[model samples]
Target: MEYQYCETDPFKRPTHLLEANPRGMVPAIREGDWASGESAVILEYLEDRDRDATHKVPLLPTDPRLKANCRLWIDHINAKIVPSYFNLLRATDRTNQSEGIDRLQIEIRALVQAADERGPYFLGADVCLVDIHFAPFVLRLPRMLSQHRHWSDPIPGTRWHMWIEALERNPHIMATTSSSELYLETFDLFMNSRLANGES
Candidate 1:
């Protein structure tokens, strides 16, 4: 499948995008006359559309119960984990920052404990929707936490470390990910702006 890039600046949203998706989100996709917004919806569309085809790996499992579990974890990450991480990054004051960090640590531990019994990826050996949804945020961890504080090992133990290692090794993730240095530079700019605005 081919995709066209439509660069969206949240500060200067284009009219075409507003027409396609009133929400003005960057990841909104338009296929022929069909259009969908939100990362979860867009990912589901892609997965469902290609499910019958044998050429590509299915994003969600074929088993109904497992598929439901994947969706649930994806929702958890989107609703709880990612927001907390963003809050931690955007926090300007030490009190708020500490609180954010604590919240994120709890979330991370829960995620780690929920890892599949079989191995690596969230759901056994396959890189499912949960991995896809969480990868963007987790990829930033190395640079984001390292630069901020002395507590380097936020996610301890070999299991989490191996999981992260597997994610970094995945070709799709590597292709989509920005360089750590570049991500850190952009993150620092965003954090500085948040500090200026006195936003927690």
Candidate 2:
């Protein structure tokens, strides 16, 4: 699979993205006539499709209970952490930003506490669906928030930091990671204006 940017601006997203995803959310994938949107659903689609083909390298754990647990956390990240991050970034005043930061920190701390005690990865030995879903925010948040909001890492010396150190070392993550300059530039643009459907 290939990845690409959505070419977003302050006012709107690209036309093609709206055509593919009516909700205007991203992490959308298209292959000919078939297309899917939303990060969680797209991840499920990839795993199922990959399972039918190779049956090797499952992103989700094989156990039924473990897989369901992964889904629960994914929903937490989506419904809580992600929105908090965006809300924090979009906040214009100190009061709103402080509230946003507090909310985001609480949500993040919950996720950190949920991770396995073993050093690396949420599930403890291998990267899984939860990590993939959260990695973008992990990679970008430090620089973006620090530059804009003077935010600092609140959960240092926790399981979350350990897992992040591992993620930073992952070859695939290193390969796909964008420059800080580019990320901050895009973030600066969005800080002033809003985009729809949790995308920007």
Q: Give the top-scoring candidate (lDDT).
A: 2
lDDT agreement with native, every candidate:
0.77, 0.80
Report the error of model 2 at residue 43, Å: 1.1
Model 2, 1-200: lDDT tens digits are: 56565544424666777666766666577767878777788888877877866536678988999989988999999999999998998887888888988998899889878888885888888889899898988887776988787677646776877877888889977777778887888786675455534544
The TM-score of candidate 1 is 0.83
Compose the digit string of candidate 1's lDDT tens values, residues 1-200. 56765554443568878767788765678877888778888888888877888777688888999888888888889889989888887666678878888898788778877878655889878898989998887788776765773224544446777778888899988877776777767677666666677764
> What lDDT is reached at residue 159 by model 2?
81
Candidate 2: lDDT over CA atoms? Answer: 0.80
**What lDDT is reached at residue 107 by model 2?**
95
Candidate 1 Cα errors over 4 Å, as ranges:
5-8, 14-20, 149-151, 154-157, 192-200
Worst 10 contiguous positions by lDDT, candidate 1: 149-158
